[model samples]
Target: MSQADKLRQLLAQDKLHVMPCCFDALSAKLIEQAGFDLTFMSGFATSASRIGAPDLGLMSYGEVLDQARNIVEGTSIPLIADGDTGYGNAMNVKRTVAGFAKAGAACVMIEDQLAPKRCGHTPGKAVVSRDEAFDRIRAAVDAREEGADILIMARTDARHDHGLGEAIERAARFKELGADILFVEAPKTREEMIQICRELPGPKMANIVEGGETPELSHQELHNIGYAIAAYPLTLLAAAMKAMCDALAALKDDEPRTHLLSNFGELREKIGFETYYAASERYSTSRRY
Candidate 1:
């Protein structure tokens, strides 16, 4: 079966899937090596990794697609890409879904935030009209009908601008509109999390942003609350950033903590050096140019 089909089957089973966000191919491979069945291609991590910018809708669809392609190539695990606001309107949503599916995404998440969307945990966020949000999801569902098995995860950031009730209502509507999964982003309390799962129908996903507004729950807790998937979108990025900063600071202090970093051979091995070497040996006889 295809990776998308595999992901669908996995979601169908009675268990919670924890997907850590990966910004690039190496991280994706590491996630697979860590024995995860799936990984999320986060826009926040991608924007930060690619251009050192925040996730304020700075990265374009093409850039995210490139990153998704690289991650798909690097790992066999299913990837769910973050397609922020579908990169435009309903037509854009359709195109975004098709493009991500073509680029090997097992699923794509489209949010309801307005243009130049901010992070879900950030303030000053605004969502489009309810009709517009429905249209975007409908477009994505239609796109999926055109021979792409990619799942559509409809996300609502209405909880910040609107209230929890509104967020729950929007999630219900999104589920009715054919979203394979519902993500009500940034629920503040544990009660709200339970309420969301109890109220919303079908498969549900939860976002666990460290130090964010949402409460960080364990996988079992999330499963008990009826969440099929829980995504830690910035955990890897945050860890990587802190490690690099500390490494730089140590280098400036003349401490040069080389042991803290991966060796060159190990890095090469992580990036599939052995696979390339085997391919070269199988296809060629000599190394002379």
Candidate 2:
């Protein structure tokens, strides 16, 4: 089955699907090896990894697509990618959806934030007009109908700028526009999270960002609140960052931080070094010419 179909099947199951955010192919492989059935190519993480920049709409469509392609190639799990603001207007959203789907994304999340969009948890984020936001989602739905089975996840940042009511309304409209999933980003309180799942129609996704504006709820807690999918967008990134920092500090003191790192051999195996060598050996000896 196609990756998109696999994701759809997973969503159809009567349980919450947990997707950890992977910033690159290595991270993607790690997520898969760690037993996750699905992964998310986080825009915020990608910007940080690729350009060492914040998620202030700095990464372009091409950049994100390339990263998505790398992650998709590195793992067998279905991947959901963050398509921030679809990178432009409605037409741009169509192209963005097509590009990401072609790059092997099972689902693409397009938010309603305006141009130069900031991270959902960041302050000073503004959303487009209701009509424009709806147009973007309609465009994404149209793109999906044009032969891409990629699921369309509609995200609304209106919760921070406007209010929970507005965010819920936007998510409802997005659902009407054929969004496969709804994401109301940055709901500060548990009550707001519950209300979002209760009020929003169809399948819902919750983004749990550590230390962000939204409360970090466990998978079971979110599932009980009616969330279909829960994404920990920066979990790996945050952990990796701290590990790298401490390792660097230890290195400066001439103290090998062996305990702070994964075994090199195991890390190579996790990244498919053994499989690669075996494939090379098989192909090298089986050549007919």
Whose lDDT is greatest here?
1
Q: How far out, in Å, is residue 174 in model 1? A: 0.9
lDDT of 2 at 55: 93
Deviation from native of the Cα of residue 157 in model 1, angstroms: 0.6
lDDT of 1 by residue, 51-160 (tens): 88999999888998999999998899999998999988899999999999999999999999999999888878999999999999999999999877799999999999
Tens-place lDDT per residue, model 2, 177-259, is 89999999999999999999888888898889989888888888988999988899899999999999999999999997999
Question: How much does each candidate deviate from the true structure in C-alpha RMSD?
Answer: 1.6, 2.1
Residue 206 error for model 2, in Å? 0.8
Deviation (Å) of 54 in candidate 1: 0.9
Model 2 ranges with Cα > 4 A deviation: 285-289
**Could you tell me the TM-score of candidate 1?**
0.96
CA-RMSD of model 1: 1.6
